[model samples]
Target chain A: MSGVRVLVGTRKGAFVLASDGKRERWDVTGPHFGGWEIFHLKASPADPNRVYASQGTSWFGQLIQRSDDGGKTWEPVGNKFVYDGVPGTHLWYDGTPHPWEFARVWHLEPSPTDPDTVYAGVEDAALFRTTDGGQTWHELPGLRTHESASSWAPGAGGMCLHTILQDPSRSERLFVAISSAGTFRTDDAGKSWRPVNRGLRSEQIPNPTAEVGHCVHRIAMHPSRPGVLFMQKHWDVMRSDDAGESWQEVSGNLPSDFGFPIDVHAHEPDTIYVVPIKSDSEHYPPEGKLRLYRSRTGGHEWEALTNGLPQRDCYVNVLRDAMAVDALDPCGVYFGTTGGQVYASADGGDRWTPIVRDLPAVLSVEVQALP
Target chain B: MIRVVLPAHLRKLAHVDGEVTLDVEGLVTQRSLLDALEARYPMLRGTIRDHVSQQRRPFVRFFACEQDVSHDAPDAPLPAAVATGDEPFLVVGAMAGG
Candidate 1:
């Protein structure tokens, strides 16, 4: 029987929500590594049973956990993430240069073909790779050591490399998104990188369209159309069709474009989803109504999908990594909110239901469809 | 047997209950006891101390005989009460965070 597993990372810990193909009646097993913050959890596409989690606490520093039995059991692996060379420095919030420091892992991207290979996007804006199934990690320093890196500054939420995307058709091509540093691409693997923020404009910075220094919240792409990318910037919704060589504004009619998470539909290459928050500073639904906007035509034309979401008195915010889509036949959409609710829709985004509630504030959500 | 009391979170990570007892082969100092502790509970390596510096974590404190031994030298000999197992060496997660 086919099933779906939703790996949720929360402010407090981690939770694994499971269900059969029916897409109802979820079994929640959770609070794993309780009292500790679970930043992200992901399963390998090559081996679904193999999983990776970024577990850490303010006092204990960072630790990586690996599960071979599909989240039923886990073992601690290597957690040491040291930057290469001297690490140098980057611009601070006050325009003063500050040394790069390791804060936490913000996202985990597992290899599409190797369960033992994974990429960790970490705070202070650096990328680390683990090929020995989380036992050890080495920094892919090209992104951080770029010529423009010294001017990179932290966003409101620390300088973080929060997104990692690999080209489905090109094994050597990869993309990474960093807060306040814009997006970068590596065509020759991790050895070299270039800033691809030419079309991205951020008024918050001195130069609206500088080479870097854009606060990009999140970026998503459809596996079938890897060249086309959709992004939820700090204040705008954008689309890039030239493999991130350039981008264009597609915010269109969203009640507000200052939101976090952005995800593409499983089957529809042109369909994408975004939860528009009131503003970057406000961080809540508009008029206390929670709505998930859907763009069937990829960005410009969008429709509000609020059939089962809160219509009033809702103030929760969805994070950049809190939304995901399962590869089931009907294509399930899942997202977690700061209010500790994980909502799921079986028939795309038509209707929704909360699978589990009263969890810690959700940080990220990733789903896997079992065959 | 040198008795050690880990904080709640460390206790959970090490998967031990109550107090953890270890056999320190040499003079019991902060360095010696920590060496045995990490040897016994490998997962606790970088929790109480740093991985490279081996310095006690800022928010982690050490107490022995009701004294704040967190400032004590790593190689300095521990109090006789802790060495003799009369009082367990305490590892506390400093009063911090929400």
Candidate 2:
């Protein structure tokens, strides 16, 4: 048994699912981060011992937690996020707090360039940055709900910051996706912001702009290519060659157009993965089928991988942070669903296998290949 | 009399589809309505509240007149819309990221 660590963030708490790299013999660990809802969990690729999670509490508010011992123990990134020694007010609409952060984190990612740098997207569609290994935090400015804060609105779950992509080579280059509120980019270290969602779409606004409710769910950047990016829109999967300044539909060949999260292979940039559910009306897996689609050459063509997956109807949707690929040999792919099921692929998603079943409704899935 | 609306998933579990009417005195609290619901449909006992603490599960959300009442205390008196039977007390399961 080789060491393969799987971290799952759920509506209840965060759990660590450890495997021997065989996907057969696995052990599950506690509700780390306590009663807080965890939206995102990440195990460092540079240092497997360093793990990070975005978590929210019903009464404690939104916060980030980090673990040096994988998922065994954790501490808050910052006692409280401060700006100029003062905490910034939370972003909310109509007095009610953002619905997504009811009690969980929606996204947490560490900068690929600097291991100490961390980013978290919370329920109020706010983005927070940590540079001292999560010891202290600063709220990024100019990326709030914009002019249409109330009108843009949160979906049923209530939108928030869900995507954070940092360029591996440049710490200044970062992207944040605001569900129901398109995408925003900062190249000058958060001093200013601009809408990068040129081709994204939204139903509420007839002629959409990049600053409106484009509702971007997930964003994946090609490891080596700084400008090339891929995103899972609320309605379709899209790609951008100019770092989100523009996009094009890459979901023509998939089983269904509707989906949530999207991921790109670390080494093979063109290799991407997405779980397609039925669109707006049906909202289930395509034809009540759960299959992960792998695109070898961008989204031009997709191959459904289901060698060992369930052939029955699975309407459970996969969240944006739930599907991830380990930067291991042959590349290990993993995803958890609302059905409390986790599926893994050791050979680059060519085949699939269930690792855990009937846990809590999974909110996110993270993997760390321990040496 | 209080009318409670069960979401599709919960409706299937309650067996008798659509809204259910309940009669309660004093205030229409979540605890009182839930008790009435469980008394009428025993199968729905543990579905909405914990069998012991009677706490709501993660997904099940309570709403009255479009406002989320999930976080409200169980003993809190419900809105007039629900208490007077003019509107249904909705037990909606929040659908979110998996």
What lDDT does each candidate get? Answer: 0.94, 0.75
Task: Report the number of the highest-DockQ candidate.
Answer: 1
Q: Give a tens-digit lDDT track for model 1, residues A1-371.
A: 39999999999999999999989899999889998999999999999999999999878888999999999999998888889999999999999999998889999999999999999999999999999999999999998999999999999999999999999999899999999899999999889999998788898889998999999999999999999999999999999999999999999999998999999999999999999999877999999999999999999989999989999999999999999999987999999999999999999999999998789999999999987
Error of 1 at A327 (Å): 0.5
Top model by lDDT, which number?
A: 1
For every candidate, the chain B TM-score is 0.97, 0.92
DockQ of each: 0.68, 0.02
CAPRI-style class, candidate 1: medium
Tell me the tens digit of each residue's lDDT in model 2 across A1-371: 25789999887788898877666667888777545578778866666778888765343345566888877877655535332222234335454433222233477787665668777776556677778887776677556533444444565566677888887778787888876777888888676677788887665555664356687878888778879899888788899999888899899789787788899886898998988988765656886678889899988699988788776867787877888777667788999999888888888987887888876778899887778
Q: Candidate 2, clashing residue pairs? A: A2-A20, A37-A104, A39-A105, A77-A134
Q: Give TM-score values for chain A, per-prediction.
A: 0.99, 0.88
Which parts of model 2 have CA positions greater than 4 angstroms off?
A21-24, A33-35, A77-104, A145-151, A209-211, B1-98
TM-score (all chains, Cα) for each model: 0.98, 0.72
User: Lowest-scoring 10 consecutive residues by lDDT in candidate 1 chain B?
Assistant: B45-54
Q: Could you tell me how far off, in angstroms, the CA of residue A136 lies in candidate 2 after the best superposition?
A: 2.8
